[model samples]
Target: MTSPPRPEPRSRAAGGPDIVPVSPNPYRFRTGRVVLVLEGVLLLVLGVWGLAAAGEGTAPPAGAAVGPLQLTTAHAALLLGTGVLAVGCSVRRRSALAVVTAQAVGYAVLFLVGLVGAAHEVPTVLGFDYGDAVLHGGLMVIGLGLGMWMAGEGLEGLWWERRRRASRSDDHHRSGTSRSPS
Candidate 1:
């Protein structure tokens, strides 16, 4: 049997297609992921540069300039490890929020450690200088902000939705409704 085609939605007086409204946060899901990837790539490049400078014996007492930023061997290793992890999580469907949050905490700790070490004139394990501390603080803020934004954009809904659906299923089963096989 053939069916009739559905009519298109239009404005009656204008005889034109109706203008659809767009959501304010149209790119909510994509924004965090894109930022993560970009940051990851930046970190990777800096890490490689820092490593190269260290290997070539060109690193100074303070640190080597990886692009505009200064980095030591320890800093380079930290960047490289986190960069790889960030890139990996960004590619996954739902891991971005968790990874971003974790990275933010890690950066925050490093920032504090750098500040304390510099203040007490104690040697830091990560060889953090003033610039490195500033960089870490910035990264920590970015990651934390991104994670919070994602959470506000319904990251928690994933967990809540699952629980809601499971409860609904249980309620349905309790109702004792049965369907006859056709």
Candidate 2:
């Protein structure tokens, strides 16, 4: 005898139901990672240049002086830490929150240091002035905003995951019923 035909898999929308697959987020977490990497590179370059200037014992060219090695150390730390966090997040594929938190903290520390350097006229080993102070302040603000965006992206990812889980649960509940009342 011929075997009976198999039943078609039921869609969640139909009376019979199955798990609904969530659409992938169009903007992958990689975009945030790219931003983080770029920011980190910028910070690293600035830190290295500042350190070199400090070692030279001569004032850096106008608009290039970035204060002393002390200042540079902070910048370097921020850059290295943020870069690591970004890379880690990308690798883990499920730790955006941790990555964002690190970014936020790094940015905050960088901003505070910039402010202090600006207000106190903390001379770099290269003799920083008002121009350098203003420039650093502006960059810090930009970095802060970027860090906040990274954090926001992480939160969005979390929300997406939660929504997907909720949808799956709903599908499971509907499918468990033996029969439709109507």
Which candidate tops TM-score?
1
lDDT per model vs. reference: 0.73, 0.49
lDDT (Cα, tens digit) per residue for candidate 2, span 1-182 = 44345344455567654643332543544565576566556656665665565456563332234543343343444444555555455444336445555455644554565556556544543233445445445545654565455455334532212213456657768889444568
In candidate 1, the residue pairs with backbone N, CA or C atoms under 3 Å apart (3 or more residues apart, or in different chains) clash, namely none
Ten-residue region with minimum lDDT total, candidate 1 = 156-165
Residue-level lDDT tens digits of model 1 in 78-131: 899888888889965358877888889999998998887657554556667677
- Total clashing pairs for each candidate: 0, 2
Q: Looking at candidate 1, what is the lDDT of residue 15?
A: 68
Residue 37, model 1, lDDT: 90
TM-score of 1: 0.66
Whole-model lDDT, model 1: 0.73
